[model samples]
Target: MALKNVIGIDHAVVMVKDLDKAAENYKRLGFTVSPRGTHSAHMGSGNYTIMFDPDYMELLGVLQPTEHNAPARAYLEKNGEGIERIAFTAVDSAEGAEEIRARGYPPVGPTDFERPVTMPDGTVSAAKFRTFQWPTAEAPGGVRIFACQHKTRETVWIPELMKHANGAKRLKQVLMVAPAPATEAAHLAKMIDRETRNEADGAVVVPSGGDRADFVFLTKDQLGKRYPGVSLAGLPERGGAGLVIVADVVAAEKALGAAGVKSAGGVVVPPADGNGTMLAFVKG
Candidate 1:
C-alpha cells in the first residue's frame, strides 16, 4: 500500500557529549534554545531544545547511566557528536509502528515517555509522547529513524520559544550520506510507507509529513554540492549528515557574525560549533 505524505519531522536530534556547551554553540549560531531538561529516570537523558513553529531541534546528551541513557551515551561516544536521529511527527505511534512492521522494518518499541516542561512564564506541565524507534545499529550506513506522537502539545510549543535571532522558521530537509544511495533509499522508502524517488544525481528524495520536510539520501560528493562549505572529514559512512534549515541567510549571517560564529558560505555553520553536524541555512 502506498502511504500518503504522512511522515513529517517532529525534530532533529544532535547527540553531543555536553548539552550545555552544545546549546550555547547553537545560540551563537542565532537560535533561541530552551531551558535544559532531563527525562524521567527510566529515560535517563537530557536535552536543550530550539523550538520552531511545529518543529524543533533537540540537543540530546546522556544523563545518569540507567538503561535509557547508557545506549545513547554509547552512541555518542562512538559517533563523537553529530546529528543523531530525525524523529518524525506521527498522529499515533502504535498505528505508525504497525505500518513500519508491515512494511518489513524492525520496530524497536511503541514506548511511552514524558518529560516535565516549564513554560516561559514558570508554569509547569508534562510533555508526553509515544515513540517508535528504528535503531541505528540496523541502518549502519544510514541515518536513525523514529516516529513521535505528541500527547501534550501545548506544554512543548509556545510563542516565547519560537522566535530566534536568525529568523529561522522551519526545518526544510535532512541530508543523509550512503554508499549505495538507491539501495538505501528503497529500504527507507518502505520503512516510512512513502514513495522514494531516484534522483538524477544518484540520490533519493523521500517526502515526509505532507511534504513539509524531505528526507534526502545522497553520496558525500552529492551532498557537498548542496553544502559546499561543510567538510566531510569525519562524517559517518551511513549516518545523519546535514540539516537544511529555512531562514533569511543574509540576516542570519549578520547575527552569527555579531556573535563571532563564522560560517563557511555565510549559510553553512562549520563543524566545530555545529557539534559535528553541518548546519545549512536556506532561503524559505
Candidate 2:
C-alpha cells in the first residue's frame, strides 16, 4: 500500500494540569479560542479547546473521571501534565491508518466528527474530520495524524490567535526530546521508512513532507545536569512533552523582541526541563 499523503499539521496538543490557567497563559501570548468540545466520547476523560491559526493548537486537560475510566488521570499522574500528542493531516484518513497498522504500528480507527467553526466571512461553516492514532509505546516524534475534509472549501477558518506577525510562514519543524534517541529514531524510521540523521545533541530529525520532526534523547544524567530541580523519573518514554515551533528566524526574533518576550539569540525557550516550549525561526 502507498504511504498516506501528509497534507500538513492538523493540530498540536498541549496537556496541562489546569486548562483554565494554561488557556490564560496562551491567551497572554495571543491565541484566539475555538469552541469547546470533548474527545472521542469513548476515550472517557478529557475536554479541549481548539485554537485556530494557519495551523491548529489543541489545549487538552483531563476532566473529572468516572469510576473505571482513568486513562487521562493515569496520564496526568505519569507525565505531570504536558503535551500529549501532535496530529498531522493525512490525504486519505482510512487508508493512512490502515497503512500504519499494516506496518506493525498500532493504528486506531478513522473516527469522524462534524464541528461548526466561525469563518472570516461572518458565516458559520461546518467541518468534518476523520482521525487516526499511531500507537508507539517507546518512540518519540509525533504521535498521530488526523486527516480532514470540509464540506465547503470556500469558508476555511484559520484562527487569528495562532498567526505571528514575524512572517512565520508555516510550521517548519517539530523537535521531540527523549531518552534513547538512536533506538527511538530507529523505530520511527522503520515505521515511516524515512531517512533520519543523528545530531550532535543526541537528536534525530526524520524528514516528512516539507517539514522535519526532530527527536532528541535526554538521559537521566543529562536531565539532572540541565534541569536540577525537575523530576521525570517514570514518565512515558514516547511522545513529545515539549515542541519547537518554527518561523522566519530574523523576522520572528525582531517581532518577539518588539513584543517584550525574551529570547536566547533569537530562540525562545520555555523554563521546563524534560518538557517545555520553544520557538525558533530559521532560514525557512
- Give the number of the best model, judged by lDDT: 1
Instruction: For candidate 1, give the lDDT of residue 114.
Output: 85
Question: TM-score for all predictions?
Answer: 0.90, 0.71
What tens-digit string does per-residue lDDT give for candidate 2 at 145-255?
Answer: 334543343333554534545544445555455566566666655665566786664556665434434444444344334333334343345556444455556655555
lDDT of each residue in 222-272, candidate 1, tens digit only: 877665555667777777887788887877887777433334344776555
Clashes of 1: 4
| RMSD after CA superposition, every candidate | 2.5, 5.1
In terms of lDDT, the poorest run of 10 residues in model 1 is: 258-267
User: Model 2: how far is 257 from its true place, Å?
Assistant: 7.3
